[model samples]
Target: MQIDIRAKGFELSPALREHAERRLGFALSWAVYDVRKVAVRLYDINGPRGGEDKCCRIQIALPGTSDVVIEDTEADLYIAINRAVDRAERSLARRLERQREHRHARQPVVEITDDDSAEEFEQRADAGVFH
Candidate 1:
């Protein structure tokens, strides 16, 4: 999966980017759905009055579903990213589980007739109505 890292007030370094990727990748690897890409944004809250000011936003793309985005602000950027990624992972897991359950629930059950070689069954098969 592709990881896009962007910084607002500060320049993102190779080490930081790699660290974030490693952390996020580990979390997403356990997901049931395949992740197409992850986008992370880092920005420092400019106001002195805002407590827990560092902001981290993460967007995750999964198969057959809309992208999930999580935003968290904390005193530390790493903490914020970790929390946001954790939340995103949990949400994705729940969604994937629900989808799997729905698919199973919607499946039609096939029942075979008692007389395996009956003429009616043969006729149904010949008519392409039963297999």
Candidate 2:
């Protein structure tokens, strides 16, 4: 997966970038096949004031589905990144699970007998016309 990291309101350091990349790679490794790209935005929401204002927003682009976006805020940037990555992993897993369920939930095809057509059988079943 292609990962893009952006920092706002502070300088992006090599150590921070490496840490974020490593964490994201590890967290999202299971979804690499589905995920096309990942965008990570780190920022100091409170600026020099420093509170629980370090924010990490992660957006994952998946093929044939809506992108997953996760945001986390904490006092430390690493914590925020970790939380956001974890949330992203969970969200992606849920999405994939739902897709799999939907794919498997399709109605089974039934062969029509000489006495009844498929449509008629369905209609009868809908009208509670079982024999």
Candidate 3:
């Protein structure tokens, strides 16, 4: 998946950007085929005066399905990113699983009828065809 990372209210360091990308990539590795893109935004809510005001927002795009968005805030940006990624992983799993179940539920179920061929097959089976 394509991942884009950006920061607000502060400069985004290479280390931070790399951290976000690595964490997100590993977390969603199982969904490579299903995921189209990932967008991450980090915010320093407290600015110079810090006090548990870091925010991490992640939006995941899935082809042919609704997007998933997850957000978390913590005293440290790393913590926020970790928490948000965890939440996104669980939410994405549930959404994809539900889609799979829905597709299966929509499939038509075939039924057997009392046709001549079916009757003949049944008779042969009753006679133990090979016995």
Candidate 4:
């Protein structure tokens, strides 16, 4: 999966990039579908108190399904990113389960052939020429 990190009004450092990549990778490893790409945007939202409000928004792309987005705000960007990624993973799991259930429900059932002895059955059929 490709992880694209974008920082708004701030320069992304190597540490932040690595942290976001590692955290998102670890969190979404169990996803059922191939995450085609992940977009992470970090921004500093203005607060009334003049303190920087860190926000993280993550969009996880799933094949054959809609993308899941989760956003979180915290005093630390890393924490916000971690929380958003976790939420995205949980949402994807739920979506996958629902999709699986829907597909299974639409499956057609086939009858099973219970005959265990095929040779005997064929022999009996052949002998029916006498009957």
Model 4 RMSD, rounded to 1 decimal: 7.4
> Which of the two, 1 or 2, has more TM-score?
2
Of candidate 2, the 10-residue stretch with the lowest lDDT total is 104-113
Evaluate residue 89 in candidate 4 and report its C-alpha lDDT on the 0 to 100 scale. Answer: 85
Candidate 2 per-residue C-alpha lDDT over 54-84 given as tens digits, one digit per residue, 9 for 90 to 100? 9999999988888999999999999999889
What is candidate 2's TM-score against the reference? Answer: 0.80
Better of 3 and 4 by lDDT: 3
Worst 10 residues of 3 by lDDT: 107-116
| lDDT, model 3, position 27 | 97
Candidate 3: the clashing residue pairs are none
The per-model lDDT (C-alpha) reads 0.82, 0.91, 0.91, 0.81
TM-score per prediction, in order, is 0.78, 0.80, 0.82, 0.79
Runs in model 3 deviating more than 4 A are 111-131
Clashing pairs in 1: none
Q: After superposition, which runs of candidate 1 have C-alpha atoms over 4 Å from their true positions?
A: 47-51, 113-131
**lDDT by residue (tens digit), candidate 3, 1-116:** 89999999999999999899999989999999999999999999989998999999999999788799999999999999999999999999999999999999986554445664
